[model samples]
Target: MKKLINDVEKVVLDSLTGVQAAHPELRVDLENRIVFRGGTPRQGKVGVISGGGSGHEPLHGGYVGTGMLDAAIAGEVFTSPTPDQILEATRGVDAGAGVLHIVKNYTGDVMNFEMAAELAAVETGVRVEAVIVDDDVAVQDSLYTAGRRGVGLTVLLEKIVGAAAEEGLDLDAVTALAKEVNARGRSMGMALTSCTVPAAGQPTFELGEDEMELGIGIHGEPGRKRVPLASAAAVAKDLVEPILADLDFTSGPAIVMVNGMGGTPQLELYILYSEVAKLLKDAGVTVARNLVGNYITSLEMAGASVTILRADEEMLRLWDAPVNTPGLRWGA
Candidate 1:
């Protein structure tokens, strides 16, 4: 329950204020908690808008910039944004071409974004395409329980899909690329500890110092099971093995990201990545490119997730393309 904040109700607004101050290329709506690129609504390009809860920093919001998302709406911590907020973001960023909504597969996010897209079609004639990322291999991908959670792979999805849109790929092509990216990626996470949600004012779940949750989803959801904590190398094996087994990333060159879940330290993440690299090499899988850091996170949770994307030349080309954002800036 220890959080440094003036008020729980003001967390989203204060964060938005700080974002505007730090990133002048961005515009913030104080009342609506919507973040827009400084000069959005490009005459012919597709408008890319994405949002979810506020806890996952650099997610829907941090990706807003010249080469990524056009706008991002923020919801309460770990809660989905309202339909009106999403509708506002969609309509505000819509240009003549169309708009794309990068929605995570969480139930609340899906429902609210779908509602907003319906409203947008009626009100503004904005053709909206939503691509849900369900790259977490922990979930069963069943017809129940919200399907799979969108974890680390959403970052790669936004970057690649945004590039396609920027190149005038049209709505169908961009959407196809997005779906392809999602389908080709798989992720798995493990948490050594739990986190407090600020507004919830308590730990979402409990874990002893020696207990680890193997298949963790974001937002403190129940993992596959709890077991005694293991070494970094062992933990990396557990996380990466499941991801590789679920997807055939070994078929070709791959892009890997050993992402920390907000609370894990860099030293430990690298230790884990060392093991991941060795394992891939042992399996005859070529590591074309890799990112090891906190790209997507569950607020203040001590854990990490490993994502592997089975990359073709086109995907790798987009991955190498220029990207400029507060959280991730490179290649440009």
Candidate 2:
């Protein structure tokens, strides 16, 4: 594949070296494949940690900072981090209060994080709780997960729950907030093109020029179905309808995100966002806060995903809280 890297095996390590150099605010543990916020384990704050494969940039790693994740472990591309690596991250960030692991609803991620929590509890005596995000309404099952994949809501969860952790909520309270967020959010994604994994040196999947994959997962796996490509408005409808139908978003203010899947340009994403916003407005859903950009991505995949969270006053307040991270930063 035509990717910029020294070698296939060194991609994660080399990219992490660049992360360490680019952002001094983050402490990078290259050997262990963990990224930590500088000056971690903030006395009594609940530490937040999330991890996954390496191709999805500005995800677990880009989110390590003052108001989001305190630490993130990196796996190989689209692979789950080992239990030992996760245990290291949990132990490193435990501040006596406890640590919260925000795991996406992928089989590998869920199992690995669960094992890590057990190991950390036994070996380090550090309290650990986990919040599994299964916000994608794309499918009831997928190759990588038993239920819906976590998808875009994981981003919203990290920001909102991270604020709670930063505000010194105990581990239990933070975990509760995370669960609440997951219950209130839903997501759907579509893909126009496939992504190429550097190690494999080929696109993960193939799509005809006139075709699109609806209900796509982030790993470049096959989506729910393939359909003829359509207008942005039609695509937006396909995304929003399932979300609104699955959850009653009109009853409250909503936080909406129109996320690009790695390769889609901001201009295209904004156009798609405009369409999504219009649909939400017509459906009587108030958009309290909106994010339009690439947050969670599949490696150079061309597509977009929409995430909607039914926000109560507390969730809205948390959304407005100050956050400082490489991926998302505002009011910090």
The alpha-carbon RMSD values of the candidates against the true structure, listed in the order shown, are 1.5, 0.8
- How would you encode candidate 2's per-residue C-alpha lDDT over 199-272 as one tens digit per residue? 89999899999999999999987787899999999999999999999997648899999999999999999999
Instruction: Give the top-scoring candidate (lDDT).
Output: 2
- What do the candidate models score in CA lDDT, each in turn? 0.87, 0.93
Q: Residue-wise lDDT of candidate 1 within 209-244, one digit each (tens)?
A: 789998888888888879999998888789888887
List residue ranges in candidate 1 displaced over 4 A.
141-145
In model 1, the Cα lDDT at residue 124 comes to 83
User: How many pairs collide in each candidate, listed in order?
Assistant: 0, 0
User: Clash pairs of candidate 2?
Assistant: none
How close is every model to the real structure, measured as TM-score?
0.97, 0.99
